[model samples]
Every structure is written in C-alpha cells, then in structure tokens.
Target: MMIALTILALCLCTCTLAGELFEPQANAQNTKASGATIKADPFQQRGLCRRWAHQSTVKNGTLYMFGGSMLLKQNNTVQEVPNTEFLQLDLAQSFQLSENTVPWQKPKINGDTIPPAFSAGAMYSGKGDFVFLYEGQTPKNLPEQPSSMWGYSLINRTWQMTDRWNHADENFPNRQSRGASVMTSDGNTGFYIGGLRAYENDTFKGWYYGPEEQFTVIDLAAGKKSKMERLPLGQKRIGPNVVYLPIGKKGSLVLVGGTGEYKVRLSAPVQNATKMDGINPDDVRLNPMSQMDTIWIYDIDAGRWFYQTAVGDKPWERKNFCMVAATSDPDSSGNKTHHIFIYGGGTDYMTPMFGMNDKPFDDMYILSLPAFRYYQVKLGDVKPDARQRMTCHVVNNKQMLVLGGHRVNSSETLKDCRWDELNLFDMNTLKWQTEYNPSDPGDSKFIPNPDVIAALGAKTQEPALGWEDEDVKCLFTGICPGEQGIEAQKKRSNARWRKWYIAVGGAGGALIMALIITMLFLRRRRKENKALRYELEQLQLYFQYQTTGEIYSSTGVNNLISDGDAFVSEKVRPMTFGERVKFVFGKKGSNNQEIPTIFDLPSEKRRETEVEKIP
Candidate 1:
C-alpha cells in the first residue's frame, strides 16, 4: 500500500511538471505578435554579457550610457572588467531595429576620458546640455576624485572638463558606491547622497564597514558647492534612493530605504600581542547595519530634515535598487506630483527566504511625497526577473526602460555578470516589452565627422567592421538569442520529444486513467492533510503568542500582539509624524495593544498603557 501511494505521488508530480513545461509556450503563442522583436543588435558585446552599475541618462532624443563593470573571458576564466567606453542609442529609432539603418552608435570619446571605471554617478543637466560624471572607484582599487567634473556635450559631440562642485569645507566628496545623484528642475543645483564606504584612515577595517552620512550639494550656476550636510545623527545609510522634489520657494531631497551598519563584535584577544595582531581578522570586527526602513526627507530650502511616515504597504529595506522620479506621474487632479518609482533590488536584510544575499525582488514600488504613501505596482506576468544594479530610466513621459543588471540565482555560484537585453515598462498601459537585439548593430562604432574632429583637435579611430579578430571574439562573446527567441527555439527543438510524449500518452491512457482515479482520492487526502498542518501551525502560533505576547504579521504591515483585549479598528486612520514615530519605535497603545497611534493625538496627550499580566 505504501509503495503504491509513493508511485501515485510521483506520477502527480510529473504531471505538474509537464503542465508547467508548456506554460511559456502557450503564453508565447498567445502574445507572439505583441512581443517586441529585434532586427539589429544594440549592445557593444553580446552573449548575455553585461556591465553593472553603469550610469545612463536621456538627452534630446538619445539615451547615453557610460562606465561600469563587465564580465569578460580572461585567459579561460571569466573576470569582471571595468568599461570606459560611451555608447548611445537613438530613442527615436530604438522602437524598431533594422540591419540597413543602424540605431545604436558610439562616438569616439577622446580627450580626458572617464577614469578607468567602476560604478559611478552620472546625470544629465538639462540647462547645461552636458552630462556630469561624479565620484566612483577606479581600476587600481582607488577612488577617482578628479579635481574638475567631466562633462560630455550633446550639441558638439565632445568631452570637456568643467568646474568641480564639492563642499567648500570638505574639499572633495567621499569615494563611494551605489550612491544616488539627482539634478534640480532648474538644473542649477545637483545633489549626491548615501554611499557605502570604508574609513579612509584605517586600512585594517573590512570593506563595507560603514556608510557615508553626509551629502554634497553642488551649485552648477555658482560653480561650487555648499558645505557637506550630515544625515540625522546615528543614522548612516548606503544605497538609499534620494530624489529632489521642488515646492513653492524651495525643495526637498527625500531619502528612501537603505542599509546601514548596526553593530560590530570583536573576537577574543590574541595572547602575546604583536604589531600584526591589530590588523588580524579575528581582532577586526564588523557587522552590517540594520536596514533603515524609515524614510527621511531633507528640506533643502529650510536646511532641516524630518521623518516621513508613509501610510500604505511599505517596501522592504533593499540595496542596489534603481529609483527615478516619474515626471509623468499624475495625481487625482491630473496634476504632476512628486512620485518616485523604485525597481529591482536585493533584500539581504530580509530573513532568509532562500538563503543569505540570495533574494532579489522583481517588484516595482511607488513613493509619493508630501503624502508619503507607498504601494507596490502589480505588473502582470510579463516582467523582468529579479535583479540589482540595473539602470532604470523614465522616458517619453510614461515609459521606463531597464538595462544591464546582475542576478545570482540560488542554484548558481555568485559572480559579477550582467543581463544583456533591455526591458521597457509602459507606465500607461502597464505592459512589459523586452527588446530583442539579434546581432551587434552594424554601426556599434563611430568616428566623428572629419570637420568636427579637426575642430576639436582630436583624431578619430576607425570602427571595427565586425567581431572578426580572435582576441575580440574572446573579449566580447557574440550576441545570444533573446529570451523570446530562445523560448521559440526551445519549443521547436522539443517538438519531436513532445510528439513522442503524446504518442506514449495515448498508449498509457489506461494507466493514466487508473492513476487519475487514484489522484482523485489522494487530492482530497492532501487537502485534508494541508488543513491539518495549517491548524497545527495556528495552534503553535497561538501558544507562542500567549507565552511571549508577540505575534508577527506576514503582510509586511504592522505586527499584532494578542492579549484578547486589542481593538483593531475596521478602518484605521492615517497616523501623524510624532504618533507614527512613537508607535513604530515600539511604544504600547493606551489599551495595552500593539496598534498604531491615532492621527489627531500628540504624544504627550496620550496616556500610557499598563502592562496586562497573562497567566
């Protein structure tokens, strides 16, 4: 009897797998025409090779991407390499790919090129007609702090050095990674905030020891910057999404979810202390700071900071996420609002759903300012997989394009690899479109016009005809079929096997029939077992709550505690800043319940609750 049941379970599992195998094919067949396909390649290199943490900005009708890390085959082993070349894709022509008409172009960027790249900050200044590049690490494992800012001209197609905008007191901005940068609406001021850094004076400390608390503001009009402003005391952040929102006379720089350093633990002291002991790993201690789930807003005009307590389902603490203000976001009145879109990031702070640093999110979230409301956008089944360090840009008012990111699956070993294809999310339609690039677009390389080159006093190099050289082939693998193309190919390749399975299914129909009858009985039994298991879990949770008085909410909302006296209102009102801070920081309610504070009450006016003893 036991053996028969085991075989029955195996057959059911196989049936489930078989059903899943055809799901993609079914969806692909349904949406094949609507799916975007490519006629020409857009990437510099191919075969799913990607560069991470590069900066991209849209200007006029072209999208400019520059600098980052790419994984390349180096002497049989794949290694992460820094890329300094500049690539541009014509937005007007990107919708349709063509072999005859090259859409992606690269201009010969000569004269004071970007420092050997690592992930850096880059933004387009609408007023300047130039893109500004700022603080990032170098190939030699040092921070690149050029005295002057590097600016690329869209009008003249030339690179020119510009004034260095830094804190007058600090002299230079701290070198860091995953920091957020934004320019104001007027384009006369820019801001850089929240980066991961190690103490420069101490070499023995481990990497990611701390986060930079201060932010630098640059006055593009004045050709200088104000003094560095420190973050709230005791609050250091890295990888936070910072954006500027202009109000009547001034603006606010809003800082969103980020990771910070919490504590460090030192190992036992070594006997017979020596000079090297201080630098030993056992002696040096470090711990990742807890994720600062709270949101902080800096009023640039007032030179003050305040907490923004949101009122909806808040996003979890994440790092390496890309955020861009949705200039096209309309409010209820059909007016532009300060709404920021956050997408694709890793949640290392989340309790190990799979394992450590293994969970990346594919979901998108919106944070509306002043209102400080948060809600996740439900993108249909068609969306990019979980990834981080991607460049997401808002374009054409209602479209978001994501390109070049890294993902580490649970089954795969961790490495610095990037996804090659670009994905677009239609804000209005809420549809996802993955652009296909079959081969490197013929015009991947460019030589500036002779007249322009002579005027700039720089020589131009001829572009490579193709990936014909052996070394070039090794460095940049040829393009790979995109996800859609690969799916179609896979279906065709498996057609014969699928036919065989169908023929065998005919012969095994009797056996399948008998198994189906058995499955009917087993299905009912499984449901009963599931219900029993759920009941057991609830009972255990009930006992645990009774003993500890702490009950967690899986919805990512506020946790509820049970003493049988809590009154959870059917309609919970919005909470104020003081009440939110007091409740979120772990104060009990007036009725000894773990509920959020009321909107209209001040902290001093609310009476403290007495502890109820549970026996």
Candidate 2:
C-alpha cells in the first residue's frame, strides 16, 4: 500500500512540475553559464511541453511559468526532466497571432539562483517587478535543503538571493511545499495555501489529518511571510487554491477544491469515480482527494471563516486540477460578480470500471459569486483532451491562458490548443477559439446560468452558515449589523437549499454500489490475495536458496572447486560443451578460462613426491 501510494503521489508530483518546467529560448543572444559565455541557440532553450503541477502567474500583460516536470529528449532517449526555464508570452502578441505558434521567451538568467525543477510555490509581484518563488521539491538525487526563497526579475532578466532567502529563519519554517497553490491579486502581496509538507516514506506522506491548517500569508514587498494561526480547517488539504477577492476591508480569501481528509463525501461523483468497487491497489492514495466536497471563505479583515456551497452543474470533486478567477467589472449599478473557471484534473481510480481517468477531465465549470452558483460552459466542436496538473491564468480579462499539462493516461489523445505549448479560451464566446484577437470582446460581465437562476430565482438566497462572531457577519455583509445581502449575496439565515448538495440518486448509487463492491471484492480478493501471498513467498524462497553465483546453475561450471562443490551433488552437475560456451561467452557474458588445480596430486602421488623431502 505504501509503495502504491508512493508511486501515485510521485506521479502526481511529476505531473505538476512537468507543468511549468519548460525554459523559454532566449532570442538570439549570448548568455553566461559556468563562468563562460555561450550562444543561446546552442544552449537548446525550447518551448513548453505537456506539463502539470507548474508554478505560474500573469502580471503586466505577460504570463510567466517556471519550474515543472517536462518530457525532454537527451541523447535519443525520452526522459521526464524538470523545466527550470523561465517561459514568458506577451499577451498582446499572443492575442494577435494568426496561426499555430509557440511564442515563448526563455530569457537568459543573469544570476546563479535559478528556478527549481518542480513543486515551487510562486507568485508575480507587480510593485517589485519580480517573480518570487518560495520552497519547492528538488530532484530526489540532489541534496535536500531547508526551503528557501529566490526572486527573479522579469524586467532585468536576473535572479536574486540575499539574506532573505535563508531557510533557517524561524518565521517561514513551512518551507517544503508540494502540490500547493499560490496567488496574488494586487501583485505585491501573495497567499500560499494547502501543500503536503515534510512528506517522506517514514511518515504517512501527508495522507490524513496532518499539519495545522496551511495558510501562509506572504508579504512579498516586505520580503516576509506569516503563517496565519487564527482560522484552521478541520482537515488538511493538498493542491487547494487560494483566490483573493477584494470584498471586505482587507479582502476575503476564497478557498476552493482540493483533497480533504477523513470525510468521504461527494457532491456528485463522476461516473468514472463511481466505477471503482473498492480500493484499487494502484490508486488508494488518489481516491479520497477525487471528490469535490467543500469550499470555505476566509474574511481577512474580520479574521474568521465562513462555510459556503455552490449549486447547479457542479463539478465532481477532484484533485490536481487547476482553476482561475476573473471578476466581472462593476456594472452601471456597482454590482459585480466573480467567476472561477475550472478545468482538467484526475478522478478516482477507474481501472475496474471504464479503464482510464487518471487524468480525466476535459470539461469546464464557472462558479459565479454573489449568485454563488455553478454553470458548466458548453464547449465548441474543438476542445482539449482529458488532462490534469496544468496551471491556468485569466488573461486580457477575456481569455483563459492554459499552460503545461499532460494526459497521464496514454489511451486518451493529447490535444494541444491550436498552438502546441499553450491553450486560449474565450470567456466571452464560451469557445475554444483558434484565432487570437486583441480587439475581441472583454470579460465584462457574467453570462447568466439559467439553471442557477431557475434554482435560486434572480437573487441569491443567504447561506444558513450562522456566524459566531458579529464582526465576521459585518465583514461578510459589508455593513454594521450586516443583514442585507450585498447585492443579492447569500447571507440570509433561512436560504432554502443547503450549502453543499449530495445528489441523492448519485450519492446513493455510489454508496450502494461501493458497499456491494467492497463486500464482494473483499471476499474474492481475500482468497486470491492469500494464494498470491503464498506464491510470492515460494518465489522468494526459490530466488533466495536455489540461486547463487557460487553454484553451477547461476555461475558457469565451477571447475575451480571450493571444498563445498568438490562432491558430485546432482545440483552441481557439469554442463555440456554448448551450455558451457553459452554460459561463459554468449548469454552469460562471462570470461572463459580454464581453472588450474594446484592440489591435483592424489594421496599416493603426494606421498611419493614428499619422500624426497622427508628429512
């Protein structure tokens, strides 16, 4: 089970770093490396590859991706390599391009500090003009460090490591982060939430209830970060997203879907997720995280947390998925809405059911705020293949810029969006558009979800999540004695529909089928496992006792007999000429040499020879 978990977890880790891992090619310039200047083209800087679990952010009309696992060819062999390349694409140029193009600029870094290969928590700081990356998973072969920090200037094309990058600092002890998400709204201050920390073979590898609620508030401009201790989630989450909404005084951080612990519940289990009868050995670790079970919103100004839920076309709970939020501009009435666009993630184990879904979502969802409802976007004829671990960003307030992800399952066809390295989605038209246009419509408002409107009427019903603190209510409602919904906000005490819905038919079906499958599978698997255990034991004995390099079976004819092999035991039988030739020269690839017996003289011959020396 541990081994299985390790493999799956490692693969997930692989998927993400394989994400932002690509390095952009410097534009026909010379760069310094190892104290020597080298032509950029000769350095083999390239574009993005199929990736996931990458660190990415958009700032100042440019999208930056760094640190991810990517597939690269070295000496004719395809290997999973980490991308340390800084990839950038100008939003204006990309939106104006005509045909398929990989417009990535891999700037020549001017300093020693470089982006880690994968799993680094990162954000783009606008005020400082730097991309700050915090702790990340290093290559296993490399020496592990206490997590540190590094700042890369996109403008000056340099990396910086000062005293602030120290890992020994008591403040930022939560250094090692994997499967975490980082985001910034103002571009100066960033928030990093939910990551597996201090994971190892010795521990549960961050499986269950571990770590105090992970919510590190980073002040990038100050070169410091603080782990907020006030609010704690009941369970630890992996790969969760922290989206900043400028709602309350200091704003609210919206905590979206990721893997939660202990509680095994689902809003609507995907058909693929429900197929597994019991824990498949290969996917035991992935099952719990595949359900979209919860959402929590934290009010920074009030220092409190409020539970929230979504209705209408909700996505099945999943992990290793990516999402980005785009708030609609305020309308004529000063009414605004927030839209969280979600795409591509792995589902529950499905080998028993339909055969594949390890990276199984090609669908998309829009969770609009204020209305607080979900709306599934209708895709055009062309859409991406099922994939996961990719990072996405909202660009130009109109299109979603998706970068670096892979189809973990080879059975599914891998589709690059028009261009090979990136995908562009038009939020206005709800289409996977091939042509990029700068003058196209902007993402100014939320297109209505009729299903949501029908379910909750025009106004959003209030959440029954009664607040313990008056301050929190005020923060949520945006006024003292806050009771009125902030422009159709769902803060009313008696809103009919529940926060999170467990679809009766779907949940019941999943529960019943799961129980039935578990019972039967347990019964059958027990017998089979017993037999398998016995067979494995016997094979272990055979390999341990029957095979040895000193024996005639494993080694060639042991003519240089040790005292143990002197006797003519059947196990030590001599080989035929062909067998000897095959063993020594061909199949066995051993040296062919005649063994000289220094003590070949018989007893009589020994006595006769010794007579002369009998003094």
Candidate 3:
C-alpha cells in the first residue's frame, strides 16, 4: 500500500511540473490566436562588425565612431586588422527615419586621409569637438605610442597640431591597452587615468606591468600634466576605469571598481636605507589578490575625494564594466541627474588558478545619486545565462541598447567568440527585449564589431535635410535626431511639481487624520467623565446618610427625626429627599429575606440609638 501511495505522489509531482512548463506557452498561443500581437519597436536594427578598441564620440546632431581592429583573413591566417576609416550617422535624421524604410548610411569623413589604426589610448574633449589620439597598439608587432599627440577637430573638419604635442614624460608613463581618458565640458581640462609603462632592471629584461605608477591629469588648454593620485598597491593590481558625471553644473568625475594589490612582498635589501617602522623590506610578502568595490568621487572645484557608501540588495564586486553617463532626466528636471550605468567586465577571483573560468559578466546595474542606490534590474522574470564584456549605450531616457559580449556557456562551439544577439532594455519598465540580427545570424557568423554600435537616433522630420536651421537647433537642444524630441525645461518643471505635490499631500493628509482622531478621543472622554461623576455623587450621598444617620434637605427639611441616642440623633438626620431615599434603600426589609423594601425598614421608635456628647 505504501509503495502504491509513493507512486501516486510521484505521478502528481510530474504532472504539476509539466503544467508549469507549458502554462506560459498556452496563454501566449491563446493571446496570439485572438490576433493580438505583441507591440514591436520600429527602430531595432542589426549592429555592424567591430572590435573592442574602437573610439566613439557624439557631436552636433551626429555620433562619429572611428577606427578599431576587425578580424580579416590574410593568406590562411585570421588576424585582427585595424580599420582605417570613420563613420558618421546623423542622429536627428535617424530618429525620424523609419527603420523599415531608411537604412543607416555611413558617410566617410576625410576619405583617404584617415588616421592610422590604433586602439585604447584615445580621449575626447566634448566641448571643442576634438578627439585626442595618443598611444595604442599597431598591426605590426610593436606596441606603440604615437610620436606626436594628434588632435582631430569636428568643427573645422580637420586635424591640427599644437605646441602641446609630446610623448609621455618620465613621471607621466604611457603604454598601449592600459588606460583611458575622459574629457569634461569646461574645454581646457581632462584626466588620463591608469595605464601601463615598461620597467627594466639589470637582472631581468623590461616587461610591461599594468596599472602603473600614477594617474595623470592633462590640462590640454594649459599644456601641463600633474599626477592625480596613486592607487594603493599590493599584489594583483590592475588599471582603473574613469568616467565623467555631468548632471550638475559643477560636475564631478567617478572612478568605479578596479583591481588592487594586497600581498606583502619579501626581499633582502642590497643597501641600508631608512628602515620603515611598520614595513620590513627583508620580511616582505605579497598579500592575496582582491578586487576593489569602492567608488571614489573627485570634485573638480574642491579638488578633494569623497567616498560614497556601497548599496544594493546584492552588490557586485567587479572591474572594467562599461560605465556610461545617462544625460536625460527621468524626473523631468532640466538639471539632469547624473546616472552611472555599469555592465559586464572581467572579475578577479583571488585564487592561484587565474582565468581558469574567468568569463565576462552579463548582469546590468545602475547607480543613482543623491539617492545613492544601486538597483539590480530584472531584465526578465528569469535570469539570463551569464555573459561578460558586453557593450551598452543609452539610446534615450527610455531604453538602453546592448550589443554582443562573450558568453560563459561551454556547450556552444563559439566558446570564446563574440555574441550576435541585439538586446534592448527599457529603462522605464526594466524589461528585456531581444531581436536576432538578420544580417548577422549567429555567433559563428562574421558579426558587427561590438565597438561600432554607437548611440545613434532618428533625424528631425521637419527640416528634411541634415544641413538646415531647425536641424542645428534640434541637435543642440540635446535631442537625438529621431524618436520623440525632448522638451528639456518643460519636462523638468512638470516632474519637479509632481514630486512636490506628492510630498505636500502626504504630510497634509497625515496631520489632518491625527487632528480628527485626537478630537474624537477627547469628545468621548468628556461624555464618560460626565456619566462617572453622576454615579460618584449618588454613592457619596448614600455613604454620608449611612454613616451620620441624618438627612439635610435643600428645602431646610430633615427626613430622619432621630431619638436621643448616640448613633441616631436628630442632629445626624438625612438632609434632602434624595438623601432620604438613599437611607431608606440602605436598610434591610423585615418580611421575606429575598426582597428588601423601604416600607419594611425598622421605624424610628423601634430603632436603638446611642448619643455621644462633645465639648
């Protein structure tokens, strides 16, 4: 019997699991059969093939993305070759253009005179429309830093050389694939943070150790360089990723997660130096590898560092995630709140086996401040399989467009190959929508390089052409060329008023409810006090009559005509009709024991009393 019961239970469990698996599909089919198709976004398109080292920058109504390496076949060898040219997309026109009808036309800038192929050491000066090109790896075996600093100007449509052009100085070290630069809008200032430099000793040939000596702040306007600060060093140190936050007028720069040294080194000293008090050179040791989860904020005006505390339900400890500043305000404040959106990168595991299973991250997160909260966005109800090194860009206030990255799933043939799926996340709704790029069918196919997917939108419809007055105004207004244009001031004002209304209404409602409750309690207490006083007064009168054996009436009448006894004298008489009634009710009846009546009470003559004389 027990065996039969167990079999029945197993069957029931299997049926339940099967029901759950097919329930969603059944519902979806029913909805589809009713001719209700899910809403599809019109602007979705397949991205172009590109490399990780490409440079992307936004300018007047256009997003200009330039050269990076792409895999090309030469003879029988497949190798990464640098892209010579750049592409420009008119964002204003793109936003208004229908995805089905209009295809992205890549316009060549400076056709044959394009700069040589490079990667990593490129910086952008947002205000002047110039990109500062410096050190990067070449197709040749040599890791090279450009002999001269090249400045490409967007306004003049030309490259210019300044007196400030020079290679990395002794204190300012440079090497390819080590650091990145971020430019502020104030024109003259920018920061060059964390890169590698070559170091050599007599015993060993020179080798490149990354996350080198110190970060440098380059004053392009002044043509001077200074060390920003040195990160704490121990063991397993890596370069830092720096980005600018331009929401406020006096904007600040943010440094996200990076690798740091933790190990103590042990070595014998060759010469006698001032012995450090806590640190012993002879007993040197290197600590374990640790990834830094700390975020450092640099104030441009104050020139100081302030730390923000870590937040989120499950905070991520990661480095090299893509960080982008969200320029549009969801709160409708013309003063756009700075939002830093971070996605996948490599992680340090602090173990002897490094890179054994180190894959890129697919998780997406956003950091919003003044509130200082990190929300792990749910892309779908179910978590996606792990992905790493993905590229992401904010398309607008509503959506963040994400492109290819390396996946961790080992069963697939393209184990370390790039992903081809185009995923779109609606920031407002936190929903993930995916579309397979028809141009690039699968991971194995030659897909667009991850770096080429720059943030571009539709162009304005009214102007009809790229070179028009309305077109210029639309771009300068901070609206992407296509989709619904942003009305900056009006939207911000409405958001501010809405927040104010919620706060004020909440406070007023609470106070009004408290006042009403207090009034009701006081009114009920007053009624209870009146009823209690009436009962107490009656008790008091009854007690007085019982103790004194006298009644004093308000009409100057005494109800108890007492005999001359000590306890029952005329002086101790009931004073009022009310008091007399109390005295009569207080006495026991002579007839039946169950009933006590005033008429059955003992008469004054039959009552025994004793009188006490007082001086």
Top lDDT prediction, candidate number: 2
Question: Highest TM-score: which candidate?
Answer: 2
Q: In angstroms, what RMSD does candidate 1 have relative to the true structure?
A: 31.1
C-alpha-based local distance difference test score of model 3: 0.42
TM-scores of all predicted structures: 0.55, 0.61, 0.48
lDDT of 3 by residue, 188-300 (tens): 67676554443222332332444433455666663344434554321123335667765333566777664444333221212233421111233322321122223456656
* Tens-digit lDDT string for candidate 2 (183-236): 445655666666654422222232222255366666677545556332243446
| Predicted structure 1, TM vs. truth | 0.55
The residue-by-residue lDDT of candidate 1 on 1-615, one tens digit each, is 999999999999886666544433432332232221211122435422445678777766677877665555333345455555467877765453222233457654433334334355555553566766655544333443543455776666555556653333353333455677777777778887766432222233222413233476766554344545556544455556777665423556767765554333122123334321121223322323222224565656546454433444456557678887654334354444355778877654322221224356688876654344555677878777778777877666556778667665334543533443477765544557554232244422222123322322211111111211222121112222442232343464367446655877755755655665587457545644543343334334433444454544432323333333344333322222322322221234564544443222332223244311110
